[model samples]
Target: MGRSLDILLFIVCLAIITPTLNANKLESSEYWKEQRPEFDSYWQEKAEIAKQDNHAAYFPDPYAVSGNFTASISEIITLKSSRRNLKGGKGEKCLATNPVDRCWRCDPNWAKNRQKLADCVQGFGRNTRGGKGGPIYVVTDPSDNELLDPKPGTLRHAVTRNGPLWIIFARSMLITLQQELIMTSNKTIDGRGVDVYIANGAGFTIQFVKNIIIHGIKIYNIQVRQGGMIIDSESHFGLRTRSDGDGISIFGSNNIWIDHVSMRNCTDGLIDAIMGSTAITISNSHFTDHNEVMLFGASDSYPEDKIMQITLAFNHFGKRLVQRMPRARFGFIHCVNNDYTHWEMYAIGGSMNPTIISEGNRFIGPENKFIGKDQINAKQITKREYADAKHWSSWQWRSINDEFLNGAFFVNSGPELKNRPFSRKDMIKAKPGSYVGRLTRYSGILVCRVGQPC
Candidate 1:
């Protein structure tokens, strides 16, 4: 029959292509059984018994936690909900709490709660004065009467002359007379801790307007051997006149607060917000000498250009044993926790574009840095070798690196001495000092959790 009709059409095309090739091999074995348990839990978290049973045994890892929050109210200040909130105050004990209380406890009356507090009034923005946890205006230098608005009011006559608000008592008021304290914000200048003495002839100037408040003042001798602070621009070139001494300027303002103030030896920059001073907050505060402490965006009068996030926390930097510090350019700096000690030369000098996160904050002794530009020589700077070792304790074991735990977002709970990977034949058959080139471990004395350098 014609070879059985061509073997019955090759057995009906192998019975219809063998079940469509076994249904594409059972859909690729059910897509690898649905990706094999996420590839065996990502190789069992890169095995080594789950990285030595989750590492981070202290060192400087005092339970590391960086920005935006992962734990750091200073590690729950004693805890009891942080001692029911840590109350303390200024004038008639300003208390009210819901979210009030940050005196760090010792209970000298338990006040604090002007909406929570935040206003040390730095520069100019809009007629100054806003609210939250009120009272904290330390803008000194109005010939020492201790600045209550040394003159100049507008913004509808400053809410009927300090009634739209009120809070001015500049520590014992002693700027002597360099003159220049033109506060045009809603206003508030309480220097509870005192030391607004800009003596040496004159030094003090805050212009324009906004919701201002400058806490705990301490400006020191402004003889002006040079130039220091003059934001949002506008001052004479000749010998720096203080039409009202411009020590804390912040023109074209907006929600400002320069807390716990201390701008030492003052030429400038204990504070300077320059044009467009928007939602700002320079926390803790304690800067040294006076070359530079804080300066963001140069400014072309009221020119803040989208002035974004600015929060330099904790604060404490140094410059007096002699003096000189402060150099700024861009903004967006959230230099966490802060603390940097007697730096002979520089820590973070200049070069602006701004995007500095920094984190944890601590940089102790022995200066000699060059960093970028390929100048990476290091004999010390890992927090000055555990604060000059010999049994160092809790400065958080100097710098610490394992690449800070590669790809770190903070709180990984294990590996991050500096990024641990090594394998170029284990870094050329490692043997010299059993490896120190990548910063393994040495914990303690790192200090500077919050002493502004942003």
Candidate 2:
């Protein structure tokens, strides 16, 4: 313990003295246009999908009817209507509370039939089938020795492979990356059945890629990494810029899902999706001890993020989080069924004319810590930055059936879109916020043994 503390102090001192290096900005790179020529088309497809997700996806009318719903929406409705609280027979504790968890948890053979999770994603990223038909590559080594040419059986090598790959760990290990782990096209980093921690080092960078599922791992204590020659793919290695120290940076990616990960104390935001990244979902994860928790858009000037569509569902935002339990700009964010145990500042905030649908969330305000008198609007849950009541009042930021306690409240605006006529026949309804505790009981990385359920 003393040795670990000494090492941590040394790292902190190094950070204080070193010159600040910027995160990897692919746009500034000369290889941007050539490497990601398909950005325009991908942006359009994700925009269309986000436009379709406006209201009917959040609050479905049971009485309205039509047939324009796609097969994936039908699956969500089927799963929603079929949610049964399964009892653990003979003293086993089986608790698959939400629709996503019901899709795959409590299955004893999850290790053998890992691909079944591919069929389980919901919301905007439901179509993400990450590494479903790919070969499984087991990571036996946790070292990040070769930054340019990673050795086989390491996490770096597994994620940088071509085509599709389902990467798993051979045992419980801690991987302290020397630099950002730049990922390739199709990959699923499944850290179930053992503890896998990426800590005290650089985190992940999903830059200009597609189709990724990262589940059941812990990422925290991330620090910035300097730029150097790095191998990003099987047939590629180049000098890359420094990484911004995000726990997971999704830059210009599509069809991504980050689930069941526990994160805290990062130098930057825990999860940041920027540069027109779309078709993303962050669910069943636990976040704590950080400020600027998640950012869906890079900047207000970068209106290309108008195509960004994201889903924040079933996550638990825990203690010591100051703000930005996802601050957004120029995108559509569907935040549903999440638990906010505490927040020193506002819970959700945004700018630009983004469409934010917040539904069925439980917000428990922080206990009064002031000495003499209470802070003005200390328990206000929503914040609209740099906009007056006139402009943001017209933005489509609506709250539906959310439960607030301890003086917490959401100052909502725009239309009550739930009353909109439902044209799609297929839909899944959001459960009440009272059920958030039950749904998020098993949030964050699960403790799984091979023959037992996860």
Measured by TM-score, the strongest candidate is 2
Number of the top lDDT candidate: 2
User: Candidate 2 — worst ten consecutive residues by lDDT sum?
Assistant: 61-70
Encode model 1's per-residue lDDT on 19-89: one tens digit a residue.
21111111134534542443233234323332231121101211221221213232333243544543333
- For candidate 1, the TM-score is 0.25
List lDDT for all candidates, in order.
Answer: 0.36, 0.76
Residue 23, model 1: Cα distance from true site in angstroms: 82
Question: Candidate 2 lDDT (Cα, whole model)?
Answer: 0.76
- What lDDT does candidate 1 reach at residue 171? 37
TM-score of 2: 0.82
TM-score of each: 0.25, 0.82
Expressed as tens digits, the lDDT of each residue in 228-302 for candidate 2 is 777888877666666777899987678889989999988888898887787788889999888668877867678
